[model samples]
Target: MSTKTPFKAIIIGGGPVGLTFAQCFSAAGLDFTLLERRETVTPEEGAGIAISPTTFRIYDQLGLLDAINKIATPIPQKHVMTKDGHRYNSYEFHLRECHGRPMAFVHRHELLTMLHSTLSDDAKSKIQTNKSIASIVSTDHGVEVTCDDGSVISGSIVIGADGVHSKTRRLMNDLSGHEEPVFETTFQGMFGNFPRAANVEEGSQMEPGHDWEVHSDKISSQCFVGRERGWFIIYRPLAPGPTRERKTYTEEDVQAFAKDLIEMDLHLTDKVKFADVFKVVNKAGMTQLQEGAVLKRSFQRIVLAGDACNKITPNVGLGYNNGVVDVVYLTNALKKLVEDAGQTEIRTETIEELFARYQEDRRALSETVDSAARRVIRTVTHSDFVKYVLDRWVNPVLGLDKVYGTKVMGPLLAKQQVLEWLGEKNYLPGKIPWVHRGLVAGEVKA
Candidate 1:
């Protein structure tokens, strides 16, 4: 006799998205397992994450609102200024209107710890760390997953919550004969905790004293005042060097890079010291985000979520939140299907159709967000006349608060508006936008 598997859903990855999915599955009373390749929940180092209102709403549902509220610091205003320190435009987030909570800044690891701690002991037992997935096979009955340890597990459904470099994605692509994904470029970042200088406000720009100048061309820096850690600063090279071999940088190398950046910039010299910072330079890259039709033979039983399916630029910080929403819609769809099939077993066709709806609902939202984020990048990076006008004149006059707040940021907060837009555009069922289709067809593959 064959052995029976015990899980209703199997989540690949234990990162924030995967953890959030596990929580949702657990709440729904589904037997699930979350497998993570890493050994621990804490990040290797301290990195900042901005939690938008949409993300906060989801956190609220997960009963983590108070925990995050107590620890996270709010951002009262964001100023877009010139290299010489002239304020071009500014926008202040209306904290009260944003899901009855404020936009927050917190250490990434702390946030993950809070989420992980919330899991019930029974649910916590379901998480398996240091188990790397090797392959996935979609069969007539269910999905079979093979791990690096040679262990085999089966579940009725599999969620590829694994990130951008997902093995789940590779398995699906190989099974489908889809074209390989192309990598766009990479970003190098260095961050460290700094003592709160005397003059900095609760939520303001980081300057040595009341008067400070920031070098625009060399470095891009942001500071946040936290509850416990006091203050932290992150400085990124605006024009990162070309993509080279991935190699770990030592503390000495990081310090040297920091010193060079400060020296080259001149404007940041007095504000920060090489001795007071800890830095790491990691290659962060983007891939062209695309997905096949859910009805396609390739997409029959497999589904992709989060960065695995649609990778977005990080300008608006919606990547993780959007992925959570993907899980929300996907699980809700599965729940509805299970209810509809009450007395009878759910058919593969019904599952496929539900996933199709999920693709449609999520794809359009992803495209809109991706477009806006890329536009922001292009606008900020541009030295062209038209872009200058839009960034300087148009943005300030129209109010970036209204433009970004109403157009891009608003949808994340308002689900009805998003759903309405997706419904009207018929984005469900994985319909490719004509423009995107054309671009992908012509672009060189990496």
Candidate 2:
């Protein structure tokens, strides 16, 4: 009689990180199931994502950049100005000469579509929508995950790729006899894109060389121009309140606010102003960000990835990129653990040791980034005293605009990814060689 290969992994959430995990799992010869709650994945509000050099290299290895590059734009320079329309400075931001990869901007839907398109037919078939997972139980044999339909599935381990509010994370903690403190909604963000103006030609000055960032005593606003549309964001740190709820905005409400934002003299083109762009972008959102992480990420049979593990303020655009890195590291870890079984039974103690190490490696990086994001937002949007220092001392004496955009902070944005450390090579030469730190699968760094 022939024995069956045990179902190895159950992936909760089929967003970018989940799908990427699914694909990586497949490549490692692991059999897994991917569950998504949406009927079909679609863009919630279309906005561009900054493809930092390191992130671009990873996508290139994943067979995604070719497709993404077709629709994405390379941002070369960023222009900084005050709300009063005084030009502060402009710098070569993409730093392609230094990093070997330009800062590329692709809409959220476009990248997700590319990720989905590149998935193998076998991998695509593993994705099941409308199948909501309710709870997870780790058995002596394997993990048993029950769906809202009362249906059950068996797997050796569960990976949570769910978003910031992850059901899988909660269930994993509950099942493993751990309790996590509730996270606070410290800040909120509003962002969306407006259609390109009629005069905004391909490779126009506005398209490639200009990203407008304006600062005032009270607030800061960020905007970037593209061939097709413009992306903008305004971060508002919430004051302490009894109830933690995000401010809601309607399309009409946000559009009206856009007019007020540019009530001063801010113009993309002579003809097309900030006021004009808002009329075109129909989809917009305002959401309270849960900008921190729990102390632990895993408990034996279950582990977390993406926003579920580290939800940061989107001000730095590190939210998804860091999550993607999380997927890569988690994937590498699981591949080794799955291989280690070697036809023997997987023990709870074995998985616990593996997961504990993984948590140690990832949680610190997540927390550091989350705290850094909060600090950046504070410097830009806090009281007039800080703004005075930024405008007078920081921008003029120290050249803060150039400092923040290029010199010191650039390397952190372009650090090497997991695949590179795994020895999966990319064609683009990295600027600063990132030491492997000996972080291969199933090995603890001394």
**Ten contiguous residues minimizing lDDT sum, candidate 2:** 416-425
Tell me the tens digit of each residue's lDDT in model 1 across 102-134.
567766777788778888999999888888999
Model 2 misplacement above 4 A: 1-7, 94-98, 200-205, 239-273, 396-416, 420-425, 437-446
Residue 122 miss distance in model 1 (angstroms) = 0.8
**Backbone clashes under 3 angstroms, per model:** 2, 0
RMSD per candidate (Å) reads 9.8, 4.4
lDDT of 2 by residue, 1-446 (tens): 12335747898998778877875676667788988888765445566677666666566656666777787788776655666656666666535766677676767877777777787898889888887999898865678889998888888888898888899988987876787765567655567777665433334334543567655554566676666767776665566632344455576766555665668544444334455555556466666667678777888778888888787776666777787777767666667766666676777677778888877776555766777776666666654586667764576567664555455445554443455333334555546454442234566532
Pairs in steric clash, model 2:
none
Query: Whose TM-score is greatest here?
Result: 2
C-alpha-based local distance difference test score of model 2: 0.68
Best by lDDT: 2
How far out, in Å, is residue 217 in model 1? 4.3
